[model samples]
Target: MRFKSLRKSNQVFIFAALLFAGLYYGAGLLVPLTFAVFFAALVLPVIYWLEKKTGIGKPFSSFLGTLLIFIGIGILLFFFVQQLGVFLQDIIESKDQIISYLRKVQLKAADVTGFSLQEQNKLLEESIMELLNMTQTYVSGILTGITGLVLNFLLVLILMFLVLLNRDKFEKFLMMYIKPERQEETKEVIQEARKVAYKYLWGRLQVMTILAALYLVLFTAYDLRHTGLLILFGALITIIPYIGPFISGTLPILFLIIFGGTVEEIISFTILIAIVQLIESYVLEPIIIGSEVEQSPLFIILAIILGGMLWGPAGFILFVPIFSMLKIVFDHTKGLEPVGYLLGNERPGSKENLMEKIKRKIGRKN
Candidate 1:
C-alpha cells in the first residue's frame, strides 16, 4: 500500500512538471487563446441577449459583441494617450526644476559618501551609457513585438467570435470525453467555471474603477501634479494582484519624496492612500467579489509567480482564474475534494468578521 502511494506521488509530480513545461513552451499561442476564451465568456450573455431580443443571427450577434469590446478598448486607449500627453507636458514644463532637484540629490549623495565630483560624474556617465544600451535593445525588441502584437490581437478577436458562435458545440465536445453518468456533472462544473471567471473579471473592473475615482477625487482636491496620469496608473495596476497594488501605492509617495514635498503633505497622502486601499481590499472586494473564486491567498500568490514565469505579464492576470476553475473541477471529481478544499479560502475555525457579515447580508439580498 505504501509503495503504491509512493508511486502515485511520483506520477503526480511528473505530471505537474510536464504540465508546466507544456504551458511555458506553448505560451505564445496559449496566452492569447486564453484571453480569447475569457473575453468570449464575458460577452456570451450579451450575444445571447442580442440573439433573443433582436432575432439576430448568432454570427451577427457574435460580431457585434466583439465589436463592442473593440470600441471599449479603443476608448480606454484614447483616454490613456490623452493623459500620457499631459504627463509628458508636465515633465517638459518642469524640466529645469527637475534638473535642479537632481543636482541637489547628487550633492547630498556626494556629501554623505565623501565622493569627489569627478568620480561621481564618471560613475554617472557609465550608468547613462548602460541605460542607453538597454534602451536600444528594448526598443529593438518592441519593434519586433509590434507585428506579433497586431497578429495576436486579430487572433484574439477571431477566436472570441468563433467561441461565442460555437459555444454550444464546444460544450458538446467537452461532453464527449466524459462517461454518460458523469457528463452532467462535468457540464455543471464547466458552467460554474465560466460564471466564476466572468464574475471575478467583472468584479475586478468595478473595483479598479472605484479605486480610480477615489484617487482622482483625492489627488485633484489635494492639487497634486500629474494627477490624471497618476490616478490612471494607480487604478490599472491593481489588476495584477499583490505586487501591483504595492507598486501603485508606493509610486506617488516616491514622486513626492523626489520632488521635495512637505513632510505633512507626504504623510497625509500616505494615510489617504492607505485608507483607499483598505476600503478596496476590505470593503469593495469582499462586497463585490466575495467567494466567487474562493481560492486561498497563498495559492493565488503562487499562481501569479508561476504564471509570471510561464507567460510573462499575461500569466499574472490569467493564472488566478485558471486556478479557480481548476478548483471547481477538483471539487466535483471523486477523490479530489480534499485538494479542492486545500485551495479554498475557508478558515475552518475563524468566525466571520463584520465586513464578511455585511457581505453575506448584501449577497443574500442580491
Candidate 2:
C-alpha cells in the first residue's frame, strides 16, 4: 500500500510538470486567456451589481462592464503613448547634455581607478554602443509584433465578456463535476478563492492610487519636468514586487540627471522617494492591504521570478494573485494542504513559533 501511494504521488508530480510545460510553450494563447480570466474575476462584482441595480439580463450587464473596462484601458493607453512621445522628444533634444554627463562620469571613474582618460572614454563609448544596439533590437521586435498584440488584446476582451456572461454556468458546471459528498467543500473553496482575488485586487488598486498621489505631489513640489508622466511610471512600476521600487526610482533619477537637474535636487528627490517607500511599505500596506494573502516571502519571490520568465512584466504583476488563489485551493483540497502550508507565511504559532512558545512556557513553569 505504501509503494502504491508513492507511485500515485509520482504520477501526480509528473502530470503537474507536464501541465506547466504546456502552459509555458503555449503562452501565446494562455497569456491572454489567463489575463481575461483574472480581469473577469476582478470585475465580477461590478457585473453582478449592474445586473441587479438595473434589472438587466446578464448578457447586457456583462457587455456593459466589459465595454467600460475597454474604455478605461483605451484612455490609459492614450495618455501613456502621449507621455512617451513627449519624453522621447525631450531625450532627443538632450542628447548633447547626456553625452557631456557621461563624459564627466567617465573622467571621475578614471581618476578614481587610475585608468587613462582615453581608455575610460573608449570603454564608455563601447558601453553606449551596446546599450543603443539593445534598444534598437527591442524596438524592432515590438514593431514587428504590433499586429499580433492587437489581435491578442481583442481576444482577451472577447474572452472576458464571455466569461462574465457565463460565470454562473461555469460555477454550476464545476460544482456538478465534483463528487456529491465533496460538492460543498468545493463550493467553499471557490468562494474563498474569489474573496482572496477580490480583496487583493481592490487593496492593490487603493495602494496604487495612494502612491500615485504621493508621487505626484512630491514631483510637483520638486518642480520636476514631466511630473505627471513620472508619477504615472512610478505608480505603475511599483505594482511589481521587491525590485520594482528601485527601477521606478532609478528611472526618474536618470531622467533628472539627463535633463540638467542639480546634484542637490537629485539627492533630495532620492531621499524623498526612500521615505515615501518606507511609509507605503509600513503604514499604507498594513492599513489598506492587510494580510489578505499570506504567502511566504520566499514563495512570493520565487513566483515573481518564475512569472517573469514565463510572461514578462504582466506575469510579474499577475502571478502573485494567481498563486494566492492556487494556495487557497490547495489548502481546501485533500492531499494538498501540506503544499499549501509550504507556500504560506510563517505566522504566529506556526510549528517553529509553537516550539519556541513551548520552551518559554516550560522555563516559566520551572
Candidate 3:
C-alpha cells in the first residue's frame, strides 16, 4: 500500500511537471488554440440556434456564427482604432494648449520651490523629450509585431470555425476515454462547462457595456474631450481586472492633466471612478456573473499569476474561465470533489459574504 501511494504521488508530480513544460514552451501555438476553444464556447449556443432555427447544415451555421463573431470584433476594433486616431489628433492640435498648461505648472512649481523658471523649463523639456522617445520606441515595437498579431488573429478565427463545426466530434473523442457508465456524467460536465463559459463571457460583456455607458454619462457631464475614445478605453481595459482598471483610470486623468482640465474635474473624476470600481467589484460582478463558477478569490488571483507566468497577457484573460471549467470537471469526477471544493468560493462553516447573500436573495426572487 505504501509503495503504491508513493508511486501515485510520483506519477502526479511527473504529470504536472510535463504539463507545465508543455504550457510554457508550446505557448506560441497553444495560446491561439486556447483562445479559439473559448471563443467557440462563447458562441456555441448561437451556432446551435442558427442550425436549429434556420434548418441550415452544421458547416454553414458554424461559418455564420464564426462570421458574426468576427464582425462583432471587427466593429469594436474599428471604433477603437478610429477613436484612437481622433485622440492622437486632438492631442496634436492641442499642443500649444498643453504647453501653456505645463508652463503654468512649471511656474507654480518654481514659486513653491524657490527655483528659477528657466531651470524648471529646462528640466521639463528634458522630461518631455524622454517621454517622446519612449513613446516612439513603443510604437516602433508594436509596428514591428503587427504582422505576427494579424496572422495569429487569422489563425484563431480559422480554428474557431473548425472547432464550432466539429464540436460533436470533439465530444465523441473526449468520451472515448471514459467508461460507458461514466459517459453521462462526462457529458453533463461538458454541458456545465459550456454554460459557465458562456455566462462568464456574456456577463463580462454586459459589465463592459454598463461601464461604458456610465463613463459616457460622466465624461459628457464634465464636458471632456474625446469622450468616445475615453469611454471605449475605460470599458475595454477593465477586462484585465486590477491592473487594467488602474490603467483605465490613470490614462484619462493623465489626459485631463496634459490637456488642461480643471482640478475640480480631475478630483471628481477620480472619486467617481473609485466609487464605480467599488460598485463593480461589490455589486455588478457578483450579480451579473453570479456564483455559477464559484471560484474563490485567492484561487482566481493565483490562477492569474500562474497564467501570466505561463502565457503572458492572454493568460490573464483566459485562465479564470479555464479554471472555472476545470472546477466543473473536478466536481463531477469521482474522488476529485475535494479539489473542486478547494477551488470554489463556498466554505462549509463560514458565513456567506454580503454579495453572496444578496445574490442568493436575488436568485430566489428570479
Leading candidate by TM-score = 3
TM-score of each: 0.84, 0.87, 0.88
Off by over 4 Å in 2: 106-116, 129-147, 349-366
lDDT per residue (tens digit) for residues 91-185 in model 2? 55656677788788777787898888898777777777577556556645655565676687789999989888888899998887899999888
Once superposed on the true structure, which residue ranges of model 3 sit more than 4 Å away at CA? 1-7, 89-96, 113-124, 347-366
**Top-scoring candidate (lDDT):** 3
Q: 156-251, model 3: which lDDT tens digit per residue? A: 999999998888999999999999998998888889999999998888889889888888887788777888888887888787767777877787
Give lDDT for model 2.
0.79
Assess candidate 1 and give its lDDT: 0.81
- In model 2, state the lDDT of residue 245: 73
Tens digits of per-residue lDDT, candidate 1, 1-366, equal 999999999999999999989999999889988999998878877888888999999889989988977787667655765776665555556655755665676788889999876787677756744654565566456555656766777788888888888888988998888899988888889889999888888888899999999988887776777777788778888888788888888988876765677669889989998998899887787777766576798999999999999999899989999999999888898999999888888875223544678668999999
Q: Provide the global lDDT of candidate 3 against the true structure.
A: 0.82
